[model samples]
Target: MSDMRGEVILRVVPRPADINSNGHIFGGWVLSQMDIAGGIVAGRIAKGAVATVAIESMKFISPILLGDLVSVYAHAERRGRTSVAIRIDVVATRGGGAETVDLTSGVFTFVALDENHRPRLLPDA
Candidate 1:
């Protein structure tokens, strides 16, 4: 992974329950973390309610093993009138030396929402 300028949004350890049959952390679990991280960044940018509109792209670079300390990082990558794209990256620190591995990366899109849950204009940055 290249130098990511995103902020650390979440840090979690994968439990045994998160492991798949293949002995790796479930991909769905990583995806959930990415979504949560993206939402947090989007909400801060929107300064209000926001909803996930799409996961534009995702890449799994490495498998997350049990006992890995997973960190989700995210930043607002793009912004439109009412929508923002957040770039999310997941990294795993393993083997006690804290060797870092790039686990996954994704781009998630979110839209500012009004009280009625419809798209609303984003405020000036």
Candidate 2:
């Protein structure tokens, strides 16, 4: 759906060390990846330090087992003077096949900050 404000930015397969005892990718691991991927886009827009201010509606639709390639997509859904709301989607390929199934999704809000850690004007797009 084009209306969905998300884009695939990074893709990687989890290693055995990334999995929890449940044999699925750890939630923290996935969240960190999302943060990293989300930062890439947010930084360009913010033109400075961007801090995560909020996370909403995170849903893990399926377990991501080790060796399954995971894809993370993030997009700017809303923008303000010093903040941007981003949507992140995580998907895992079932096999070596091209098909992918969404595993997690959430809205992450980031605020642009200056060197002193205060909200700053967003650089022009």
Candidate 3:
């Protein structure tokens, strides 16, 4: 199912190794997906490379299970001279795509990077 959260930046499925003893996907795995999604949006907005500087806020609303199609959505929420804040939301579709669960949501800040790996001013919007 489509959501109005933002652009669907990444879609993936968790592997068996990504699960914890509780049979749910590890939080780190989910966080990594969000970071990847945020970076993609940030890079597009910056028109160059970008690095994740910080996670302003994050909340895990539900667990992810194996065989679920995970979708990570992201959008630029705020922009600065050299940094942009991307709001990311993750959802898991399960039960043969009948149910969708909100897995996590966060706002990640990314800094535009130059060839020297240092922060650079973002491009015009």
Candidate 4:
């Protein structure tokens, strides 16, 4: 939220159907977006296929509103021989884009995969 640390990987507007009973966007929906964003970065770092293996941590800072323009940001936080941990952050722009709200943040770990879908070493960086 403070000077957004990662690249904006995805930008989307929530639909009515994405809302929960509380009139806020579902947490699962936000989480999925985060995963997608993280996967993109992880795949780039791995230089091939990657699969989410774990979520090291997640925090929901605020609820997403129907009219908010959601932006997913991500960056590789750490890397191992076969896996990378991506830091993903979700922010919402509302009030005719005059306001920005910090929605959620998480660290998702992804493992590089080979053609056989088995874990593989990441490409040299």
Off by over 4 Å in 1: 1-3
- In terms of lDDT, model 1 sits at 0.92
- Candidate 3 accuracy as lDDT: 0.93
In terms of lDDT, the poorest run of 10 residues in model 4 is 1-10
How many residue pairs clash (N, CA or C atoms closer than 3 angstroms) in each of the candidate models, in the order given? 0, 0, 0, 0
lDDT per residue for candidate 4 within 1-125, as digits (tens), equals 44555899999999999999999999999999999999999989988999999999999999999999999989888899999999898999999989999899999999999999999999998
- Model 1 pairs whose backbones collide: none
Off by over 4 Å in 3: 1-3
Give the Å shift of residue 111 in candidate 3.
0.1
Candidate 4 C-alpha error for residue 114, in Å: 0.5
Candidate ordering by TM-score (highest first): 4, 3, 1, 2
> Candidate 1: minimum summed lDDT over ten consecutive residues — where?
1-10
The CA lDDT of each predicted structure is 0.92, 0.84, 0.93, 0.93
> How well does candidate 2 match the true structure in TM-score terms?
0.89
**In model 4, which regions exceed 4 Å deviation?**
1-4
For all predicted structures, in order, the TM-scores are: 0.95, 0.89, 0.95, 0.96
lDDT of 1 by residue, 1-125 (tens): 23564789999998999999999999999999988888899999999899999999999999999999999999988999999999998998999945999899989999999999999999999
> In model 2, what are the clashing residue pairs, if there are any?
none
Model 4 residue 89 lDDT score: 89
